[model samples]
Target: MTPSPESVTTMLYQHDDNGALLRTDLPFPRRSGKVRDVYDLGDNLLIVSTDRISAFDFILPSGIPDKGRILTQTSAFWFDHLDVRHHLLSTEVPEALSAQFDTEPLVGRVMVTEKASVIPFECVVRGYLEGSGLIEYQQTGEICGNRLPPGLKQCDRLPEAIFTPATKAEEGDHDENVSIGRMIADLGSDLALGLRKRSLDIYRKACQYAESRGILIADTKFEFGKVGDEVVLIDEVLTPDSSRFWAADDYQPGQAQPSFDKQFVREWLSTCGWDKKSDPPALPPEIIQRTKAKYEEAKKRLTQSEPTL
Candidate 1:
């Protein structure tokens, strides 16, 4: 029988800044998120991840030692392989910040990128049945306006993956689902369809590659930004934290499947019995260890490169 993904441990937050929003040592950054610290240094963007861990939206009090390295390194692997036009600066950094931070330590996770006007939406591509797509299908009979085959189960593969665009919410807000009409109304029809198509092509290609590596890419998020005349893929791609990774050997359709990403964290939260509306709990050592291992294993298994975790 498949087990439920829930968590019992709590994620307590001692610090609000996870080295993303406001940095003291390096030049101040324009933005920070649960895991990434970003700087707009004119010619490039500098991203750094602190050791902070978060679950269910709460940043934990304890920080993992090498979590940042793992995140940075994996992104490097993706940026290298994607070959899509992107905004990138090496953490080799520019001559500017090279004085203090060593480039080698930030591999995979840290990216020096050309800053662009981030598109207002997140490009979510789902090649399988799961998560929001599944929930949406069960309720509305459609996913982001695309109808799905009836009787699809929790982890079933879709007839074909589809692109579902969502408005980007502020850091703590949830992104509401929008229809193709809604997206086209906001972004002209030409741009909306263009974004959707590009999203599908990238997702399909990445899904095939992940399958080859013995990992299943369920669904993943991507961000795009415009640089002058080009639209580029921004942000991280397919990290465990960003995407769902199912062990290929054990994947099944009718019920929830084992996920290499967030399975331990989710399980602990459920066992702890915290209300989803309440603040999240702190992660115990075992949970943290397992979570870290899952992230690293997913990155390595998919990319065939270690992510310094």
Candidate 2:
């Protein structure tokens, strides 16, 4: 039987010491991403958000407690609240599989979705300057062909949200940023324009809502897929794992701001002296706890009250 949401939460906390679920063993064709395990269920896909965390294009040796639950539940919240066509069919595990495998570990971390031909590009929307965007701006005062005014500081809010798409890289590879013209050239003008409009609309609405809740969605990426000729949003939506979320109250434009995502992991990895080309180090217990807390806090603040959208 499917456990109640309350029961699932209880189970997650109780099972924290059992360690992060690094992998799954279901008897189905599966594809593992940096943090999710996708199982083919014929008509639909079963996506299990694992606790595995990746930084510098490498899956780290350590996992954060309850990280899977945070990402899955957070995405579920957005799927329900966002007014758009999406690939999510349900969050409940099918009875056929639940009856066969021990599903207690899957509660609050599984999504049953309609399988679609995933688009090859990531739809990235930025409302602020940071990350690779900031670096590119520093060098050429442009990001993915979008020109910006001079003297913009790091983390400064952009004049408006910009849709900067990137090629969805293979596992262990970096996603390369590209211009909208490139996207239009690759994927006809109509389809490319449609994606840009949809992505920007969703980002604007989500950012507004997030700000009202004391969080700033500085930037985020969305993935789309085609079920026949209809394009729909797929994959995780606005989760910390896919977005740069900052505390609205702590906003500062000239320097790097504190974020709710995996900043701690990246910071540690950068300062630990691990060469970017080699295997990353396991996160210390303190880093794990701090990272987990950031994710949990983001989930709580963003989903505490449902938006009217």
Q: Top model by lDDT, which number?
A: 2
What is model 1's C-alpha RMSD? 8.7
Compared with the true structure, what per-residue lDDT tens digits does model 1 show for residues 1-309?
A: 643322111111123222221121344555778777777777777777666667766765555556666666777777778758877667564555545343433444467788888889888888888888888999988898999878888888989888887898887778877787888998889888888888888888888888899988889888888998688988887777778888899987899988877678778887888886766766677777777777778778866875563
Error at 25, model 2, angstroms: 1.6
Candidate 2 local lDDT, 95-126, one digit each (tens): 99767646877877899999999989999999
Q: What are the per-model numbers of colliding residue pairs?
A: 28, 0
- Please estimate how well model 1 matches the true structure, expressed as its whole-model Cα lDDT: 0.73
lDDT agreement with native, every candidate: 0.73, 0.89
**By summed lDDT, which 10 consecutive residues of candidate 2 come out lowest?**
9-18
Deviation from native of the Cα of residue 143 in model 2, angstroms = 0.8
Residue 113, candidate 2: C-alpha displacement in angstroms: 0.1
Against the correct fold, how does model 1 do in TM-score? 0.86
Instruction: Quickly count the clashes in candidate 1.
Output: 28
